[model samples]
Target: MPAASTGRRIRIRMSARAIDEPHRVASQLELLFDLTFVVAIAAVTAQFAHDSAEGHGLAGLVPFLQVFFAIWWAWMNFTWFASAYDTDDVVYRLLTMVQMGGVLVLAAGVPAAADHSDYRAVTFGYLIMRIGLVAQWLRAGADDAASRRTALRYAAGITFVQAGWVLRLVVSETGALPPSAQVPFFAALYVLELAVPRWAERTRPTNWHPHHIAERYGLFTIILLGESVLATSRGVEGVLGAAGAGSPLVVIAVSGLVLLFALWWLYFLAPAGDGLSDRRHRSYLWGYGHYGIFAALAALGAGLEVAVEQTGHDIDASPLAICYAVAIPVGVFLMLVWMVNASLLAKPVMRPAVILGCVTVILLLPLAAPQLGVAAVVAAIAASCVLLVILTIAPWTRRLQDGCPKP
Candidate 1:
């Protein structure tokens, strides 16, 4: 009887530990929640494409950046929460459902949220989502003392930042503040938002599953890539339909497809998860750096959609459009390379590759403006991609050789 009791205790302990694992098979409900983000991505991309095509592209950037940050921030908050305290109990799962509903409402408000008359509805929805996050953190703090303190810190920091957001929205709606002042105010709040995690980690470092965080990030990357492909397909189909079904536009579209695939390959070749698993100290750099990367990827897709719209049209595509399309992807690709090098290899050689790629794309911009056109611009992007692919593989080769026994 004693042996049986001991076995039961062991099973219970193991089960409890498994619940705390970050990558613990996310519940089916969590997966369903993630699906809503697909709509969010599509909505953001659509707004970007529409604004760019209508010559209001610059106007769209602020809203796009704001929306992107909000969505990314929400995801990051939940990822860390799940990493530490994914109970997978009925209560936990139900709270996740509530958050998922909040995301949908937030997404639905995107179109008008940018220029809402009051900004109250959008702010309220966003606040609700954030409140859900705070609740999770509070729960963690209550369940475990170490985690509880950490959770309390997170809740405090995040709640403080959300209050700032609400105030900014109110000021924006009221027009009591100058436009220039608004950005600086929000910028200061952003700095605080970023600093909070570092502060919390210092005081009471939360136990996060490195592998789980890595996998969750990987899934997000795949979602961004899938959006790119979807944009490419829609762009190509529309261009082909308009251009007599056998135009060079199809070629441009195919080239864009290949370029996206190559960029995706470049991202995954570095073995980021393996490197990060053992070096939890680098999590801050890795996590924050991805924000820019994700924005760039989404913007790249939007730019590509614009390129497709201009294909075979009499309206001469501006150098800026072509440059924007090429530059965004190159920038994203380089950022990924830099992050990996910084996090894993502790080298800066990737900087030169990025500089070279940027210079190449910029030099090609004028040439593409009114003469070389979309196809040529895309070819230049592909060339830059090829250069990056070569750079990505070279270090791995050297590492492998170094690992081998002396001859």
Candidate 2:
């Protein structure tokens, strides 16, 4: 039966029930939804790079992490929820548009958020997204009888956490809380937000398609990596306009591209979609843990931008700063990817300790000689990229040597 019987069309179409399709690829609406995130990611990264270029050094990272976590968490909530219940009808599309608007508001606030002050726009944007999410959960409850209770719990939990966010915003605006109090307050709220879905899932698990969720994550990762590529190009362009494609700038640009490519290859070496399907119980670990991975990748782009600044005649880029900007994110990304791979497999597929040892060697080279130039430091990291490729190839090489059928 139709959800409404009156002559006038119902605004709530009673669409967006659980999906039943197999072999699902992301729909056009999903891709369009991701475009908003691209804007958010670009804004956040631009802020980080600009700050680092202004010599804020590591002092800028905490604020970046906080803002990034909020942005990433909002995106994750929608991704998982949509994986299970995106009906793509009129109501669903409109709510998603509202969420997209929320993303733009959030992006607009990123620069101020990075300073850990001026958070009204950011908080309001986040509240809009949370309300949009609650609507989806409530719709789910109305649409699916079997999962109504679970959906209601989700709606309740999210609504409850959103109240905490609202409180934080009010306290920040009204001076009810000191600036120092803001960190702990927001941290507590973040913890509560993270715990909600876990709490809701305990009552009854929602039907999140592992494969679809994995693809969505992968797509987001690609967007971040693309941001890295863009940053690299922008940095190179800045240097090229001033330095005229000089040797150091050219080397730095090429090495940065190589590093970005290597990270891309490393990320796709394992079939994340298949792994998620195999170990559904570990989905939370796989899903939540990716926040770090995504953040690191995006930051690495900004780091490359910092390296570009080093090529300027006026900027005196510290060797340590340049090295840290690029190397730390690369190290963190490699480590997290290793952990994800290890956790996903029942047996050890590759020796993670060996990879760690190699990464450590790569990271330490820059530290060993703090006087090293930016291009040389970038080249060292680029050399590490070769090691990763070798590691990826070794397993296939051994299999062929042993006369095993090619996978």
**RMSD (Å) per prediction:** 4.9, 3.3
lDDT of 2: 0.81
Q: TM-score for each prediction?
A: 0.85, 0.93
User: What is the TM-score (0 to 1) of candidate 2?
Assistant: 0.93
| Model 2 agreement with the true structure over 199-260: per-residue lDDT tens digits | 88887787887778878888998999999988878887787777767787878888988888
Misplaced by over 4 Å in model 2 are: 1-20, 405-407
lDDT string, candidate 1, 1-407, tens digits: 12234322322111113323433444455567678777777778777776777666777777788787777777787877777666565566667777777777777877885554334655676787888888777777676764566778988998999999888887887887787886688678778878989977777667666666766777787788788778767777776677754455665677677777777776766556556666778888888888887887788788777777777444344756655655665565566656654676545445565556654664455455567666667766766676667765677678778995211
lDDT of each: 0.69, 0.81
Clashing pairs in 2: none
Sum up the clashes in candidate 2: 0
lDDT of 2 at 120: 84
